[model samples]
Target chain A: MKKINFYILLFVALLSVLGAGCINEQTEDVASNGESGENEVTGTETQIDTIYQFSVIDALLEGVYDGEITCGELKENGDFGLGTFDNLDGEMLELDGVIYQVKADGNVYEVQDTETSPFAAVTFFETDIQDSIKTEMNSQELAAFIEDMLPSQNLMYAVKVTGNFSYMKTRSVAAQEKPYPRLVDVTKDQSVFEFNDTEGTIVGYWMPEFVNGINVPGYHLHFITTDRTAGGHILDYTISSGTIEIDSCDSFYLELPENENYQSTGLSADNEADLEEAEN
Target chain B: MKKINFYILLFVALLSVLGAGCINEQTEDVASNGESGENEVTGTETQIDTIYQFSVIDALLEGVYDGEITCGELKENGDFGLGTFDNLDGEMLELDGVIYQVKADGNVYEVQDTETSPFAAVTFFETDIQDSIKTEMNSQELAAFIEDMLPSQNLMYAVKVTGNFSYMKTRSVAAQEKPYPRLVDVTKDQSVFEFNDTEGTIVGYWMPEFVNGINVPGYHLHFITTDRTAGGHILDYTISSGTIEIDSCDSFYLELPENENYQSTGLSADNEADLEEAEN
Candidate 1:
């Protein structure tokens, strides 16, 4: 009878251990998640509508251009957007899950998954509003058109415009050497490209004014030709005819780099005038 | 022999079912988590040093006076901070996990978990820097002293000052009725209270200027006495002696309210001057 009692105790102990082991395995899966915003993206849900950005525009304006996020990592959070390559190499345009680099040499190159960006904004674009612009409209006019048609100016938007353009003016910065100068100084000697009757797409974001220091207050756009051959940061363009798709984003997840470059920069000072000059 | 084999098969199947059941129960606990920002707080590891805020200050300025988040839900994200109650009610302050409501009647009351807020910022307070102030200093001087000592103006800080005050002045707004007036208008006739030789603790945050529309640009504080009896939004104070503790927060998680009132408010417009008037 004592032997049977000992056997029963052993059986109960084994069952409890097995149950606890199964529970720990499940908890460990969740416990490994890094941060909340990060876990949300890497988790199964695949956050679609969030304006996920790596670093702030002020960091770039302050010339903190060393990339902290890889293209592969960024792509997981977004399938469409724009940014600049590591060391401010060139303008980056991401559309339909692929990243394109428009170098200052007026050549477009596909980026490696390991390549990184100093600053970028991207989202898994899903059109909330789709409309066609049959008439000719300059950059300002097109901006105003979309501005008026948006449900609310307060929300962030990922805008994609694909069409034939009468004229498209763009600029790209050369990869900077060590001791990078401020973006304002670099843009003073940026390479400019002008395309006549170019067929391409404009990928960009229209952020609210509250994001003045964090991101560009208005539209910050990049372009890629129909053949995926050429494009750069859009300076100005006259869209002869185009289809505009705007993805209204209500959530924004900003992950700031904690590098010395990002931390040491005097981000509080007014960069509006400098940002306006560099962006334009 | 066949009967014995059937029993053995049944026992194995039961064990597997029990294992799966345990695993599912653990996973469901995490699966019910609403959002990442929220999940991080409600999770086992309480997130520290995150400047967590619900709704934008611009919403309050625009008269979006309805509460969307319960005090209980907000406390999960923070143990110290300040905001107002539902219906644009009196000032609210939280310290050491307890929330206090300072009404326009010049009385402080303990708040229930079910109570809600439309706009508020909170953080789990952990001291990174602690110092004692022996010399008397006016509000401006005290603010400048703390401001100069901060590692970076770019980062948000939760500030707590506990000591003897030569003089303290605070204000609390009355709960608004339907068709709520703008916060600026409400402040114009706010109830003010003054105390001499007050022994209390000042709880607040000092956010960067970039948070202009989202939150107050500079110091936004509320006060509660040492006895935990009386307090309101800090307007002016002269500290004869105090202990200041600052918690520098590098991460800020903002969760905006999506109610019809929040959606309809024109948050894009300039609210700087109005904010200054209302806050002061």
Candidate 2:
């Protein structure tokens, strides 16, 4: 009887083992496939929309701490590195003194120096170079606009010049955003400029909040400002710099450009070409 | 030779079966432990936080939204039903228009009526209380101090809020730290206020940005607007009626009280105290 009972237990255990064994084998195969599935091939879902920031000088000098990292960090990771023109499925352009590689996917980064890094060999695309010059702005217009846009409350503004720049990994740092407002006299004498040493007249208009915000007054606006200051940065090729500050309570609506393509001045989107990327 | 070969194959197969069988037994033991581990007398490291939104009227009249499910969809499941005050761990406070059960652990959910559903049995923590009070221009003293503390350009700011009300969940949608400027205006209307007739004082404050942003306001400043209005919510009454629009922004400045205890002016820290117990 003892032997019979022992054999019954043994047989039951053996059958359970066999059943579990086969199930385990099948489950192991499923688990292995599921674990490695993530790395097999980059899923179409892996392709995500990402934005990068690039600093002109940082790319050329092969240095870190550029605008590219600042902008990229604002969105997600701050890992925008320099790229070469050769491997890019896009084009390249030279603005001011810096070289930029613009990718077909709308990614713009600093072009690496070919001589320094073997992998940095790049192709510069200069297929389209139009002399993007706008009609000049009269002295009355520039002066009137500057006089009108003075801030009432105490305010501070910043201009990002060529240098080492860094931004928080995200727009909010520990639940705080928006640039600081410092007490400044916007109407200060140094804030305004009439013209440089050039024979041609020059006028400067400053929007402290506009540039300090995310988007820079891109090239089109730059051209308008430069043209308004006729022969200033445009004719003499000198980077004209200036700002006007106000320290008192003043309510004035500065004249923003009504030009269709100008984004900074709050352009209208009714026009066909203007309808493409009009800023709200 | 054939008999010997058959014996060898059988022995190897038995060994393989034994090894797989042992592994399967061990795996089953581990899987079973998962449930026991959670309910163990000795607490496990596992902890989860969830947030829910309900109006003051809903909280007082019907009790907290009792609709809940244990394993799947709560809404689809049926009447998971109303919540009621189980017991009080510490102090009680008045907000909106009713008396709320304030737990020592800082959990401040509405005390419901039925005991059938989980929501009916559990206590809700007051993580945040929404109101409409203008903060920026209300007090010159507070406004100037906040303005002075604005961080410099490219520098990150760390602002926090801690007080009576919800702590587990915040208006934390999309992780943008800065509250929307328009929301501030929307909540600024005088019509949004209902003077607590008993105390004869108004309650509400301007809502700041929910999350961080490129150019956003700080969370502490929002606290100044929201938590300090009408000299604060009643220290002993439950929320009677609240008409405030809150997104995920409630999470803003949530972790603040965890690190530092703020001198919460409104309704006392009873709500905040109830909500933070599980976190510690």
Candidate 3:
């Protein structure tokens, strides 16, 4: 009976030691994770390439539509991208390191680096894949063709299509004053412009579906003429011939606005329907 | 005629000099911005706090249900957040510096730091605001109340609700095998659990609408008991009394999966409807 008791005591002591060891290890893990600054300072730089986003779609939908980031700062992030100026001033197209504003009057203006945007997504263009289109294709057909050629559906792609278009249809909205209306409302008064046999480039992103609320899903393209005289948000286009360059992005970064209007807006409403209406 | 010609020449020279000056400034700006690594290295460490996200809802909806980040890495980013394991194994609730897996067997297991998750949103808990709720409220009412009390809708908020609840309803999905079904389909087989007059804490986030596609808009809460034995994704709750702590985030970083499955998934569908169905 004494031997049995001693054996039981030994088992209990072993269990306690193991339990304590587990607890100690967990405590150390938590302590290390919680020490943010020290670890980051000591750790090697993260070499991840990331796509930078300014503001968010929900704030735009709720009428918090004033620019927070300047064109100068935006350019610091990427050389190619699309967005609108403050108060939905006009469609912005950044191509070949130059920023152009396509106004509702159907004329393009060279935007100063000092100008600001309420929303934008930009990336330094580095071509991962390049291909040429031999056959004529419209916007829908072009999207379909690209869809078939995509290496993967899960990754975000930045696409640049440069060529002469048989016909191009685009639209631009006038800038609004303070107390801006929602993006959908602002887009309602957009002016449509058409070009015949225009040589230009389309700058846009093929966003993954998972980024729906945060960004426009699928192909979002903007156009600018080669001469930098005309451009707008691309609605439709007939590509006579073109070369497509795609950049696959594996990292993403989002910067939110700090203004009071952005902070106070009611953002709980389901805005997908509205977003589709405005974007399409 | 000679005098006039000389004046024109002088004017042209002046114009050329000014143009050269502008071009030089722009060239410098582009050069500085294009060199990402050198600029980041030289620039002061950005003191801005940020929330990090992995994968996205749309990817999961399209059946891209595989773990890409280990629990060890996730904890390295933040100690407080919620997500699911590989193949929708169980509900993941990381609270108070410990990661817990509430399995379908209705048991809480301390997840190893080495386990991986397909999706997650985590931010170190550093409370910016703390307030006590004096009134009784249901889940909807509590959400509404919290909305009214928020400092800003544009900023992301990590919220913690701790107190005794009149009732708490939660759900957890069983672990899935390879060739997983859509999230909606997987959710159809979820197991729901309820607790009466229980004391526990809710860990979750209040995301802006602009991030709809990237994350769940509004409140997303996961629960764990005080004893750390019972918990899951919070479906509803009646809070008798609780203290709410919120941490406002101004920056966000999203880490994409490096796996091939994440690389090849088609993410072009409008997934707001599907996301709403899966989340709510």
Candidate 3 lDDT for residue B122:
79
Clashing pairs in 1: none
lDDT winner between candidates 1 and 2: 1
- How are the candidates ranked when ordered by DockQ, highest leading? 3, 1, 2
lDDT tens string, model 2, A1-280? 0011233334534664687757545433422222223222111110011111221111121111111111111112111112222211222322221334333333334545331110111111111111111333333433344333322101111111111111101000011111211111110111112233332211111221212122222111111121222111111123223332211101111111111111112111112222112211
The segments of candidate 3 whose C-alpha lies over 4 angstroms from its true place after superposition are: A1-49, A188-191, A266-280, B1-49, B61-63, B188-193, B196-198, B263-280
Model 1 spans > 4 angstroms off: A1-46, B1-46
TM-score of each: 0.79, 0.22, 0.76
Off by over 4 Å in 2: A1-47, A54-212, A217-280, B1-139, B142-153, B156-158, B161-280
Give the C-alpha miss distance for residue B48 in model 3, angstroms: 6.0
B1-280 in candidate 3: lDDT tens per residue? 0001223334443443455554334323322221121211111112114677898767777777689898877765666789889888889997755789999888999987788899898766666778888889999988988777787777888888899999999989898877778888988888899999999899999987667656777888999999988999988889999898777778787888866566656564577678877776
Q: Best candidate per DockQ, number?
A: 3
The better-scoring model by TM-score among 1 and 2 is 1
lDDT of all predictions: 0.79, 0.21, 0.74
Q: Name the 10 consecutive residues with the lowest summed lDDT in model 1 chain A.
A: A1-10
Question: Candidate 2's error at B41, in angstroms?
Answer: 24
lDDT of 1 by residue, A118-226 (tens): 8988777766567999999999999988876566556688999999999999999999987989999999999999999999999999987778777898899999999
Alpha-carbon DockQ of candidate 3: 0.29
Candidate 1, position B174, lDDT: 97
